[model samples]
Target: MVDDTLLETRHLTKEFAGFVAVNDVSLRVRRGTIHALIGPNGAGKTTVFNLLTRFLPATHGQILYRGEDITHARPAEVARRGLVRSFQISAVFPNLTVLENVRVALQRKLGTSFHFWQSERSLDALDERATELLAQVDLASHRELLAVELPYGRKRALELATTLALEPELLLLDEPTQGMGHEDVGRVTALIQRVARDRTVLMVEHNLSVVADLSHVITVLARGSVLAEGPYADISRDRQVLEAYIGSAEPEAAV
Candidate 1:
């Protein structure tokens, strides 16, 4: 059988001072799907994300992207392989305008990233593509404003736009909706849906509603191990998943 998985982790584990944070967790994120990693506080969700992006070295196991072991790869190497993580690599300059922030990412494709002496026309050439990326994240109208000038929620939107500029095949989002107001959450939820039409997304989100709405597969982590894995309907009713969330094993307590 052919492997449709875009990202896979095998026996992945992490430790800090002999305390295991992620224990033998394996994930299979298929192509063109939204996969959510969720759990209660201190379940090692972010640690798993850091491991996948190479921000933190795993104490054991393997990471496979496009069927190749990336266990020892550098952060830039993982990103260059088309597995990009938002907020880590997306350079959102506070002083630059929204469009300009995205233009910086686009400049890499033009091979003029380090050419400080490049002409204004060379940089301006990125404007059209940058504008399109802004449009993708519903930031077109705010393109002229400095990233710092935008409201908190729109600033996150700009970050999303800049990440999209890299044309990633697999996007890893760590709490894409954290610290947002209700309106901002809705808007970003919609934006995630829009951008995920073509590429796959592997996200660590705390918002169960957003996870239920966006994720094609959900992996529930508890005490540094996978408690359960399935659709939201199944995971939500799981006793173990419920106990991990609310400290009660009542199946109806809701995940």
Candidate 2:
């Protein structure tokens, strides 16, 4: 059975100073599946993310979320439509405690006024929700710790928890496992898989093994155009994909 599409790009293109970064590329992400975008450095993976999230306006294209055109929607509007992205680098508030950071996210999700004089009791429910999110990311023990004090891997986990607080229907991750130890990578890989069970995920990942392990669909990009796309096994073995992106290395276990 064909899966329903949750997000899609039609002829998505981005150009700067007459140089195209992403060229007329169309992609679809199935609802409740993990879709991975892989390519060498400068293949325009990040550019595509920016376009989808409206961080960067498309040169010419349409972005559709749940079949509604949101081509020029603001980032927050897109997010409110159940599309949220986590950056490669951590975006946590360094001075805020882990629980506080999650609480802020929950408040945003709840659409509460940001006035300082708002009743503290109003946020109690948000705090409880935040605590539940921290537990999901395995950071319940560090809830009182400052965001900057946590180790890098834990920081990444916290970022995921914050994104989850948004209650996204489609999640975009940028190099989620970047700069992590092998064990940390494995842990994050598992977390991403668990999240994918509920929300559709689209990621720009450099780690071939992670893509192979998590992606139900793989789209290979080279020089701003799609080189190949299919199941991991087929795309990983395609001659053009290997020559243009994957190179000569044997596939490694997902980690």
TM-score of 1: 0.94
lDDT of each: 0.88, 0.88
For residues 31-67, what per-residue lDDT tens digits would candidate 2 score against the true structure?
Answer: 9889999887789999999999999999998999999
Residue 240 displacement in candidate 1 (angstroms):
0.3
Model 1 off-target regions past 4 Å?
Answer: 88-91, 247-254
* Backbone clashes in model 2, listed as residue pairs: none
TM-score of each: 0.94, 0.93
Cα lDDT tens digits, model 1, 161-234, are: 87888889999898888878889999999999999999999998888888989999999998899889999899
Which pairs of residues collide in candidate 1?
none
User: In angstroms, how far off is 228's CA in candidate 2?
Assistant: 0.6
